[model samples]
Target: MTSDPQQDWQRWHERRTAQVSAPHGPLSLTGTYWLADHPDGHIPGVPGVWREEGDAVVLTATTEDGITVDGKPLTGDVRLGADHTPIPESRVATGDRRLVVLRREGLWAVRDFDPEAPTRHVFTGIEATPYDPRWVLPGTFRPYEEPHSVRVENADGRERGLGLSGELAFMLEGAEHTLQVAVEADGSLWAVFADATSGHGSYRFRFLRPAAPAADGSVTVDFNRALLPPCAFAAHFICPLPPPGNTLPFAVAAGERNVLAG
Candidate 1:
């Protein structure tokens, strides 16, 4: 560790603070209305009546509903597929609030994000400890003999299957720890993990994604960029739990620690 990691850490911390407090950041989320919970298609404060019909959502709206579809007042009915784009590009909107249609395990839900939300108003910043290069260590990616899925409980207490593509192993303290990771579409790694500090200092769990590994399975297992999941910002999101044995026994004091006042 260098003598003045504070300067670099300050810069990184400032960036994180700006990100979480941004116009449509995590704190902007106000509600998550699951279609399963409302079979009749009425989600309070949200315009349009929605129903899950097969693989798509059947939305019925009148101009009086005060709903905007594709930036124009909507009337009549429309079928909407899953919203996979960023929140800004979602098909539904009401002023600054982005209504995103979601599909998970065939179950549909809608997420509402508003810049004027109370959480966003009270958001300080993400509390993160300084970055230390020593915490960023080289690692090895070992692909699973075969990809597998495990039934894990989500933040909303729903058990759903979480797909695991491979495992990344690295030495944190003295013992080697392995984290089940997913290979994203861009070939990068994605991991959800917890440490001793979880539930005590920061979110109950955080996310980490070291850069893509080499062909030979060499990679950097940097924990300095660990992130809080969306569920940490709002209770409506159904974020999956860590896979079996994904938790580290040691306290990881790096990366984003808590939500601070920006």
Candidate 2:
């Protein structure tokens, strides 16, 4: 665990690059179809007929649809309870495309991913700043008196509820800053923010996830891994915008700056 930080950072960067370029990665996302938008449950170019079925999405298909469920051709009807399984194990497919069922805030949706997406074909690489220890600093997590939710705009120009469980407060340049944070299922702290650099030198908004808080409700707020939201990769993702008070007055000069196109 004791290797050069620069080398570790380089490896992390390499891994991030590989992850983004992998099949069904961010670039492969072609569409995120909300069920409410398509009452017929037929997503454009997606095989089969999907309809909401009480806490699940029901699929009806035929061999001519060329759809597969668990590597077997699908026909008739199969009640899918939202691809609760990992993406790799999602039950519906067409050729190399994965049809992932989803439920968000009680609304159902489907995500379509194809390895041959145009975005994936033309992607150059993610432009990331080299990691510096200074960009990583200690911070404290203070939970709210009670959980609160705020309506924030999404990358898709839609407003949705962004849940907040606490605040991560830290000092970057002799100035204390705070960001509303969500406690991930895995216990990590995730923040969505924007700054002076946004919309000019960097993506309009980015995400930062500090490591999980320690027993003392403290954590390390690392901006080196700040990320462009998935919508930055494709236009279909509904990534949430920054919550209130999460925008630091100071510029954050680290992490992926912008999308690089060929």
In model 2, which runs have C-alpha deviations exceeding 4 angstroms?
A: none
- For each candidate in turn, give its C-alpha RMSD to the true structure in angstroms: 2.6, 1.3
Model 1 CA lDDT for position 262: 43
TM-score of each: 0.93, 0.96
Assess each prediction's global lDDT (C-alpha) against the native: 0.84, 0.86
lDDT for predicted candidate 1 compared with the true structure: 0.84
Best by lDDT: 2
lDDT of 2: 0.86
Alpha-carbon shift of residue 145 in model 1 (angstroms): 2.0
TM-score of model number 2: 0.96
Which tens-of-lDDT digit does each residue in 1-262 have in candidate 1? Answer: 3466666657766777777677777778888788989988999988889999988998899878777878888899988998888787888987788888988888888989898988888776677877778788889999899988999999989899988999999986677889999888888998989999999888899989888899999999877778888777767678898989888888888998777544
